[model samples]
Target: MYTIGQVAKFLGVSRDTLKYYEEKELVKPKYDDENGYRKYNPYDIHDVITTNFYRELDIEIKKIQEIKQSKSVTDLEHVLAEQEAKILEELAYKKRLLKKIKSVKEDYYKIKEHLGEFTITEMKPLEVKGEITEYAAYEEYETIRNSTENLKKAVTLTSARRVIHFDEEGMKEERFIVVRKIEDADKNFKGEVLSHPKCIYTVIEDGRFVNGEKSIDHEVGERLLKIAQDNGYELTGMAYINILLTTYEEGLERVFLEMYAPIK
Candidate 1:
């Protein structure tokens, strides 16, 4: 038998921790009437060591208590299997977050070079398999914001968020698309797949789309239309504006977008 302090030192824990385990009936120590001191048996010390080992695996105290009550090897196996599953889930979540961080960093740097300039280029086809939902302009920002969370949650992993736009009777309408790579076979989002054909696109960084500057839109839109027409290309559909970056300041949204129009 060893004193409470000796048991705690051997287990690399505090005396309070042993007292807590005793209160939970996990470790019981005998009280010495002669000196009025608590003494833990060797078996209790071993149990404390085992508890420490389980904690290193992030097993909760409740689960550890259940494990202590386990009667068979099968019960122990079940507990370990559950722990493994939780670890896998945590790893997958962290992997997705890391991917999002890396992508945002790359986009952040890439857009700095394209600010306030329009360039005509050949854009490759976009083959995305995920969900698409349209949103009204300047109407119920909260509704859209909630939907964004739902969409992001639905996707197991996402690489891009594409917002395509069109005008209907002078009202701006947007299509929100959240897509993952083809390799993400375990993707949970069950939405329509979007396939954009390769096209000659006039890509530019314009804040007027989300910032609500109609004057800038009218001027830039007309100039872009003329540029396409002069270069022997006719715009055939609504523009697909893939926002490269967006920043919010004082409740105002500013976006740098790359617009694509199918040309004939």
Candidate 2:
């Protein structure tokens, strides 16, 4: 026989926890009328130890009770097998989550390295791999990306919008590019393929100077033209703006973006 406190100390559990188990009918402690307290016998202590062992496996209290009440070996085996399956499933989920987290963290660091730098550089022509959402609104972009279920969870907002038109009522219709960086161009892409030549690429950050007025794409393009002329590089082809960073919550006001224009 043992008091609740004595058993709790031995099992490394609180008296309150043992009391809770008793309340849940998982353990029925003998009540001493003369002492006016709960008394745990050898059997009760064994039940508590068994309960604690199951709890270590993160098995639900009710499920642990069910396992304890199981009479036949087959019944016990069935419960154990179910728990094993659940643990395996949980392990797989956690592994995937960890991999995704690591990838996103790496992306954050990579993007951080590109911040606050403006220079003329030559970038390899990237293949527009994914199915581009043509003339999509911000909401439409989200709906389309969410449908695909391939968007990185850590990534927010989306890719560049080939701003065709913008008025007081916001964007009428604009092409949105879900840029997929790939070595070989995937031929399955249904969207229009527009690749940048090995030309001057200038980046512009979204700040007070740049906002969605007459399309930041045009603004950056014009600025790139000046840069090209000043640096003795001929400014020819149309500009392609690349959205670096943004949030769905922060419309145009608190959004972070960059413009990439092809210069001769």
Candidate 3:
């Protein structure tokens, strides 16, 4: 038998922690009434050591008490295996987060690299006729492609001569294509006539199209609005994005996009 002080020294644990364990009924040592002192036997020492080992592995004290009481090797093994699986899952989740962060950083760098100095230009309101489809992003494009049958029906049925997109509320709201007739258009067609208000236009010309992603520099939009204000033009209505041409090479490695914009 050893005093609480001697047990604490031997186990390298504090006296208060041992007292806490005793209060929790996890480590009950015999008491000496003569001196009113705690006395720990060899069995108590073994339990304390085992509890400390489980605590080091981040197991809850209650769980350790349950396992200790049972002393079933299979139950303890299951707990350890479950904890290991949880650690693996957490590691995989963290890896995915890191990948996403890296991808975002790469996108930021690409945007910075491509955004050149701004230039202002004036655009005349010209009438165009063509088939127009609502612009869709990545996966949405696939859905649209399958639904529209590669846009053949949209172009043929409307007799679309030209297509244009107008940005509204951070997204392309109005997509118009100049067609022969606006009467009794199908479900996909919003037959409302749209026009741009008087505003100076900003333009950028890239020799090649940058894949499926539209190469309209939004920073140019800001510069254009400033220029329009300086040059006496009231900004009204949304800006129009016009794609002149989209060509893809046979290898799928290269794509070209020619886009123009008219801001109002």
Question: TM-score of the candidate numbered 3?
Answer: 0.41
State each model's CA lDDT, in order. 0.61, 0.61, 0.53
Error of model 1, residue 260, in angstroms: 3.1
Q: Give each model's clash number.
A: 0, 2, 9
Which of 1 and 3 is ahead in TM-score? Answer: 1
Instruction: Estimate TM-scores for all models.
Output: 0.66, 0.64, 0.41
Least well predicted 10-residue stretch by lDDT in candidate 1: 149-158
**Model 1 CA lDDT for position 240:** 56
Q: What does candidate 2's lDDT look like per residue over 55-139, in tens digits?
A: 8888899888777777888977877898899999878767757765675565455356545445555554443434455544444
| Count of clashing pairs, candidate 1 | 0
lDDT of 1 at 28: 71
The residue-by-residue lDDT of candidate 3 on 138-247, one tens digit each, is 33343333322222233222122223333333333445444322234333444445444333332234333333455544543454455556766544534554332222
> What would the per-residue lDDT of candidate 1 be over residues 20-97, giving only the tens digit for each residue?
888877777788999979888888888888888888889888988988988888887988999999999888778867
Error of 3 at 133 (Å): 18
